[model samples]
Target: MNRRRIAVVTGSRAEYGLLAGLMRLLAADPRIELQVVVTGMHLEPRFGHTIEAIERDGFAIAARVPILEDGDSELASARSVGRAVIGLAEAFERLKPAMVVVLGDRTEILGAAQAAMLLRIPLAHIHGGEATEGAVDDMVRHAITKMAQLHFAAAEPYARRIIQMGEDPSRVHMTGAPGLDAIRDLRLKDAPELGAELGFPLEPGPLLLATYHPVTMDPTASVAGIEALLRALDRFPQARVIITGVNSDAGRDAVTGRIAAFSAGRANVLVKDSLGQVNYLSAMALAAAVVGNSSSGIIEAPALGVPTVNIGPRQGGRLRAASIIDCAEDDGAITDAIVRALDPAFRAGWPNPLSLYGQGDSAARIAAILAEAEPCLIKPFRDLGV
Candidate 1:
């Protein structure tokens, strides 16, 4: 009846929000000893030092590993990854967990996966086999899938992709996207309440919740894309905009700089470094349209029955619900997409949009699997006999 020690590594606010439900379940399970390892943006001040959010949620942080360099260039991202691998390896060595859990395709998460692999600790990867073609996440995600002994894909197509990647079929589970669990479980605040918390009025116009991240594959596009989005927002002068901070990716500084300039002295626009998880979901729940290239627009926004204007190729290859409108990273295209998302006819057309990921039960399933499943250091590649 000895409990298994499973360490979960989270490096960003978004990743932490998705992993929070699973972590809570793991911590509650009598047969599991949950170890929380905070790193990357969680340790960086510019990204809001979100490790405080984890501590506020009452989880004991087993380790704090600062792995980011001082810049947002490609070289900085590479150096950060290098630092992450070494720092996370040392932390894993101290925790000595039976398995390590990671979510998504961030470079820091990749480092954690590598560290776990080199240390011979079985790894469990969530959101595996998904693609973000415009960013380097596509490569990092698949790499982690290959390294992991247990794979929890967010959807059937993703599970199939993981199997196609030569992972053992038995090890892959379609647990849905843990992001949706927050939408289902949390009592989302109403528009007025959310507005009060955000220090803005949600009324007098449509509310747009927007977030943008760097397209690491094209560094120059980050600034240009944010500029286009800002221009598009200008077309809707009456709309209230909430632009969240950029992630700590390559070219992040450029995007953040552009957003800051755009929001400055604009009474209709608000910029926030971190809204945490609750306020974010509340805003999404009440938004006229979720506008951005962030995956939350694809996964969580549609699940909340909110239309998403997903700009550019950043989210290419992920499953798209009818509620999502894909557009190029141009002001004209983005503005048109936002227009469609706000049309009452368009919103009514897809009432109760089917969630392709799952029914918000991902965390429980993932927690149960981790509690009972045996972790192996070696996984023989499964071929399709092709």
Candidate 2:
């Protein structure tokens, strides 16, 4: 019997981290053939040439699509997406897999979904139906949910949200998060090794792991918002912060500049271009709290029983575990949240064994479903009856 062919698209280091386990499971399964497509920041040097990380893990790269140029302006980003659409369409036609899998709300993923739609290929979307009102990702995620034939939601509410969006309930599955699956099966690196790899030392006292990205819809807010976060961290004299670089977005340069300036003579702060999954998860394990607008604080931090201080509109409406504390973009509010997160009493009360997003076996479940499901031909938008 011929094996089923499944293509997974990854645009950045973060998306690739979440999809890594799923790719491995599909690759190892005797009944499925995995086709990995790399694009977006993975091809950029500033993001640490993330494609090398993927290849280092032994997964085969079936195609490499270069969609993003050195364009950070809004029009430039849109043009990049247009270019990606053409490249992805050609690649999908050549590969012709039974289904294309895309994760999260990055524009590149959306471009891939659009390509798959135009080519009449089935799309399997992960992390859909969750809201992120702070940025345009909320809209992109929902749009992909509608375009997708199969939905693997991270949490139950997310799964229900997909159904509420007029998706066939039978087609949506609560598969938790593939990122959490890595935490379950993989042993994290030690703090010293992690620090050395990222070219920083792990300081004593409470730790704050921060990752911020530009809000594509509100680029102006990026700089001020990050400034507020840095000022808030300044109030915590006993705490050390580890800052990860921003994504390749419109206002990313501004945010990166602010982070560089803030980390300049501070012995308590370390900023890095990127930290692979191992170091990232290890940092999460060691940190007293995570402070940033990144989705990792909302989705992955809860699984580790760590407190997450989610700042600003970037992750505005996403479902979060009890471990997260949402604060507005104000230095005072962020400082208060950090103080509260470090309180032992407050940390003890945080909900553990929280399965808001499934039980970490999402990869196996997603793969099993994909292996058994039949692909459907794409229909007209009018036929969708939305």
Candidate 3:
């Protein structure tokens, strides 16, 4: 019998990290053929050329399309999307996969979704229904939902939202967040071991892991927000911070540059382009609190029982867990939030968000359903109350 070919496209280190467990599951299935098409920051030199890490993880990439250029302006970002669409269309034509899977709402992933739509390849979108009101991702995510035939929502509310958007309820599955799978399954290193792996010593006091990406909608918030976060971190003399670089988005250079300059001579601060998934999560597992506007702090941190000091408007309107301490973009506001996160009473009473998303079985469920379910190439919109 011929195996069903499923093309999985990933555009960034963060997105690939979320898809890693599902990709591994699909690859292990005898009836399924997995094709990983890598693009975006994975190919960019400044982003650490993470495609090598993908291969090192034992997955053979079927294609590499360079979409990221050497600029972070809106015009450059627009051109990269155009390039992604053209490159992805050709990849689909060559591979001729039964279906395509994509996660999240990066501009590059948006291009892949459009290519799948024009190619008439069934597109399965994961993490589709959450809202990030401060970023263009909210718009792009809903747009991708309309194009995708299958929706693997991380939460039930998210699945319902997809159906509310005129999609057939039967095609939407609450598969939980796949990133949480790594939290439950991976043998994360302890503080000392992680320190050795990262070649940075772990502070005995509170450790804060931060990753801030540009809010594409606001554009100006990222750099200012990160600077405020740094000022906030300055207030906690005993607190240590480890920052991961921003994504390849418009105005990202400013955020990355500021983070580099801020961490230059700070003994307690460490900055890296990428730490891969395992190492980054290991750091998260050991950190006293997580800071910044990345989705990991909003989704995965709560599941891991860690406190998150989510600053700025980047994550505004996203569902919040009890452990999340949302604050403004001001330096004083961020300082207060971090101080709250480190509080023993707050940490002790923080609620787990596992019920809001799901347990660690999302990857297996998503892989199995894709292997067994027929391709949904022509889904007619199902209106609400139908």
Candidate 4:
């Protein structure tokens, strides 16, 4: 009785949080052997060395690929991807899993997809067919969709897009977003508890859970965007702001520098390297609004009944819920959006926090699918007769 081996690659802390639930299900399945590949920012100290968080979660990491190093230049990112390909190639060769699974569009996953394609290991992608027009990740996501033999999308619209891209319809599954599972299962900390944990007081004003990343399409957007965001945040002095670390993109250093500098003299602001999944989601559950361009604002916040002020184009072209207030990168625009998200009247009228993505059973669905899926690298282009 040979257990089906499934390899899942996680790069950053945020991506790991999304994949963790599915990884757990896969690990528990008697018919499955879960192979965990940790890489990228997880290995970087400045990003909280988040691989330890995965270890703490009890997932046995099969490979620790250190593809990222110091420096956030475009050249550095390109070199890192190259290293990921070489390293992941070797890992896949050694593990020889029936299928390789990866989530979303990231540089490391790009490398993973390439290696899997060349190695002839069946590839499955989660969170594919989503678009982020303002970021380079949009192209990467589409590229991965083509390479993957199995596509598990977070929503119907995303699944349709995956099919539109010539993927065989039978292979695509609308399994919802696994991120919501954390919100459903975790015993999230309440406001008082979260405040105590973060060493902040949640009384007297709104609490903002903010996470901003570099808009990779525009090199100058990160510095300018963080500056504008900081200025907008200054307007709401009564609010407590929790700013998390940026992704390991090309412009990360600029954004992190600005965020650190802004939080230095501000008592109302707290800067965290990584909140881990539980504390982060717990904070979101208690936040006045999830403020940032991070996808959490667009996906998980609505499910948690929290409003979101999504700034800039980093998450552009992705589906948004009624609770999300999109704004330009300008300080005035951001301030206005934040005001809208915090408005009691607005939330009062906002519909049932309609989860555009399905409910929280995504991880279980994906795990069952992976356990039963037949691994085959030979796929034919699907055509929809007009």
User: Candidate 4 lDDT, tens digit per residue, 57-76?
Assistant: 99889999999856999899
Candidate 1 matches the true fold with a TM-score of 0.98
* lDDT ranking, high to low: 1, 4, 3, 2
The TM-score that candidate 3 achieves is 0.98
Question: Candidate 1 residues 259-323, lDDT tens each?
Answer: 98888889999999999999999989889999989999999998998999999889999999989
- For candidate 2, the lDDT comes to 0.86
The local lDDT score (0 to 100) that residue 174 gets in candidate 2 is 91
- What is the Å distance of residue 98 in model 1 from its true position? 0.3
lDDT of each: 0.92, 0.86, 0.89, 0.92
Highest lDDT scorer? 1
- Candidate 2 displacement at residue 1 in angstroms: 3.1
**Regions of model 4 farther than 4 Å from truth:** none
Clashing pairs in 1: none
Model 1: lDDT of residue 158: 96
lDDT of 2 by residue, 1-386 (tens): 79888999998988888999889889998988899999999998987889999999999899999988675777767887897899999999999898999999988988999999989899999999888887878888888888899889988888878888777777889988888898898899777777777666676667889888887778988888999998988888677789997998777888888999999999889887778888889999889999999988987888888899999888887777888899988999999998889888886765558537778899999988998988876433332434
**Model 2: per-residue Cα lDDT at residue 322:** 82
